[model samples]
Target: MRCYVVGGAVRDRLLGLPVSDHDWVVVGATVDDMLSRGFRAVGKDFPVFLHPRTHEEYALARTERKTGHGYKGFAFHASPDVTLEEDLARRDLTINAIAEDEHGSLVDPYGGQRDIAARVFRHVSPAFAEDPVRILRLARFAARFSDFVVAPETMALMRQMVDAGEVDHLVAERVWQEISRGLMSERPSRMIEVLRECGALARLLPEVDALFGVPQPAKYHPEVDTGAHLGLVLDAAARRGESLPVRFAALVHDLGKGETPEHILPHHYGHEGRGVALAEAVCERLRVPAECREVGVMTTREHGIVHQAMELRPATMAKLFARCDVLRRPERFEQMLAACACDFYGRPGYDMRDYPQIERLRVGMRAYVGVDAGAIARVLEDKSKIPQAVAEARAAAVADALRAA
Candidate 1:
C-alpha cells in the first residue's frame, strides 16, 4: 500500500509552522489492508484508520458524492484504484490540496505551491461550492493569514455559493468551529469584513451585522459607526492572541450596544447585563462549549465591573474579589480587563485622556485583591456573614502566604 502525507500537515510544513497533527492518504489500499497492517479501523462512515506506529490518521483514498443536503449528506467511495492526486483535488482550497510523498517530495498538481508562494488563498476547483462550510473556512483562513488574500475567482465563487443558499446547508457546529478559529486569529476583525463581503456574516451572526450602519452618539463614537467600533476592539484583541474564551469575550463584548436607546446624549445604562444575555443566546445558538459560554457570559456581564470597582471602598474591593473568584488567573483577569479596555478605548469618539482614570481603577483592583484563596474559600463557605468571613479569610490567607514565603 502506498501512502502519502496530505492536507494541512503538508501545507503547514511548507509554511514553516509547527505541525501538530498529520493526516495520511493511502492510495492502493483498502480498509482491510490497513487493518491487516496493524492500523486500527475507526471511522464509521468512511475508511479511516490510525497508524499502528505513529498513531497518525490514515484515510483511505476516497471520493465523495453528495447524497442529500449539507455536509452530512455525503456518500464516500474508497477503493484500491483511487489515487492520491484524486483525493488532493477534492479538497476545498488550493493551498490545502498539496500532498507530500514519503520522501518529502512536493506534490502540486493544482499549483498549490505557487498559490502559497503568492500568499493567496484560492479554490482548488469550481466544485468548492459543493460544500458550504468552505465559505466559513475561507473567512477563517483570511483571519489566520492576514497577509494572504482570497483570489478574485475564489471570492466570486463564494458569493455565488452564498447566493445559491448553500450556506443554509451548514450545521451550527461547523459554523462555530470556523468562527471560533477566526476569533482566535490575528485579524478577526478582517474576518468580519470578508464575511460581510461574501454575505456569510449576515447568515451566521445577524446580531453583529445589525450594527453595521447603526450610528452611535457622536460624542462617544466619533471614529465611525458601532460596527467600526466593534471591529477596532476585535482587531486589538486579535493582536493580543488571547485565549479562545477571552478572544470571544473581546469579539462580542459590546454586542448589546445595538439595543441601546438612541437620544441626544445616548447611553447604554445596563448594556453589560443585556450583553450577557445576548452572548448566552449566541453561545446557545452556535452550540459552543460550556466553559466558553460561561466565560463569554462572565466577560460580557462584568465588562463594566472594573470601572465600578474604581469607586469602591476597601471592603468593596474585598467583596468584589470574593464574588468573582472565577477570575483567579492573572492572565484571565488581565484578559477581562483588556476586553473592558478595548471596549472603552476602541469606541469611535472615546477620549483617550479618560483612560488614565480607568488604568488607576485597574491598578487599584489588582493591588487590593492580590490572590487570596482563603478569602475566596471563606466567602464561598459563609455567604451570610460577609464581613466576618472576609476578616477570617484575610487572616488565614495572610498566614498561608507567610508559611509559603
Candidate 2:
C-alpha cells in the first residue's frame, strides 16, 4: 500500500497557510488490505479508513462516474490500480486536486500549482458538471480566496451547470455547510456576487435575490438599490471578522426591505420583524445548526431594539439589557452595529452628516449593554430573581420606552 497527503492539507501547505487537518489517499490498497494493516473501515458507501495511530482519514483510491441524475447517483470504483493522477483529476477544482508524497514530492498532473500561482480557480475536468455541489464549493472557494478569480471557462461551465438544474440537486445540509464557510470568510460578499453570477444565489436564496432593484426612498438611500446596500453590509460584516452566526445576521439583516411598501417614506418601516421571519425561514430552509438559527433569527428580530432603547428610563434600560443580555457578546454586538452602519451609510446620496443620532445611540448602548464581568454576573443573578417586584418595575419601564419609540 502506498499513501500520500492529498486535498486541502497539500494545497494549504503550498499556499503557506496553517494546516490543521490532513487527509491521505491510499493508492495500490484495498479495503481488505487496509483492515489487515489495522486500519478501521468507516465509510459505508466508499472505502475510507482511520489510521490506528494518527486517526487521520485514509481513503482508498477511487474513481466516480455519474450513473443518472445529480451528485448522489454516482458509481464509484475502488482499486489498487488507480493512479494518484487519476484520483486527483476527478476532484472538483484544480487548486484542491494537488497531492504530495510523504517526502513532500509535488504531483501537478492537472496544473493545480499554476492555477494557485496565478490566483485562479479552475475546475479539474469538464466532468465538474456531474456534481451540482461543485458550484457551491466553487463559490465558497472564491470567498476563502478573496484575491483569486474564477477562470472564465470555469464560470461558463458553472453557468451550464446552473442551466441544467444541477444546483437544485444539492441537499440543504451541503448548502448550509458551504454557506456557513462563506459567511465566516474574509470576503463573503465575493461569494454572494459569484453565486449571483452563477445563478445559484437566486435558487438558494430567492428572498435575497428579490432585494435587487427594490427602491428605497432616495432621501434616505442614495445607494444604487437594496441589493447593493446589502452587499455593502456583507462587506462590512466580513471586515468585522465576527463569528458565523453574527455574520449571517449581518448578511440577511435587511432582507425584508424587499417587502417594504412603496408608500413607506423610509422603505424599511417595521422591517426588523419582517427580517426576523425571513431570516428564520432561510435558516430553516438551509437546515442551519439550532444555535446559529436562533441567534440569526433573534438578531434580526431585535435589530431595532437598540434604537428603541435610546429613550428608556434607567429601570427600562436594565430590563432591555437583561432581555438582550446574551446578545451583548461584544463581537456579535459590534458586528450588528457594523451591519446597521453599513445599511445606513450605503443609502445612495445620503449625507454622512445626517445620521449623528445613530452614533449617539450606539454610544448609549455601549454604556448600558456592555459585556463586562459585572454585567454578566448581574444578568445571572437577575435570571434567578425573575418575577420579583424590581423585575416587574423594570419590565414596565421597558414597555413604556417601547411605546415611545
TM-score of each: 0.81, 0.81
Cα displacement (Å) at residue 139, model 2: 0.8
Q: What residue runs in model 2 are displaced by over 4 Å at the alpha carbon?
A: 217-224, 263-266, 308-392, 395-405
- List per-prediction Cα lDDT, in the order shown: 0.76, 0.76
lDDT of 1 by residue, 277-308 (tens): 77888898899887677667767777776666
- Looking at model 2, the pairs that clash are 221-348, 222-347, 222-348, 222-349, 223-347, 223-348
The 10-residue segment of model 2 with minimum total lDDT is 368-377
Looking at candidate 1, the ten consecutive residues that score lowest on lDDT are 396-405
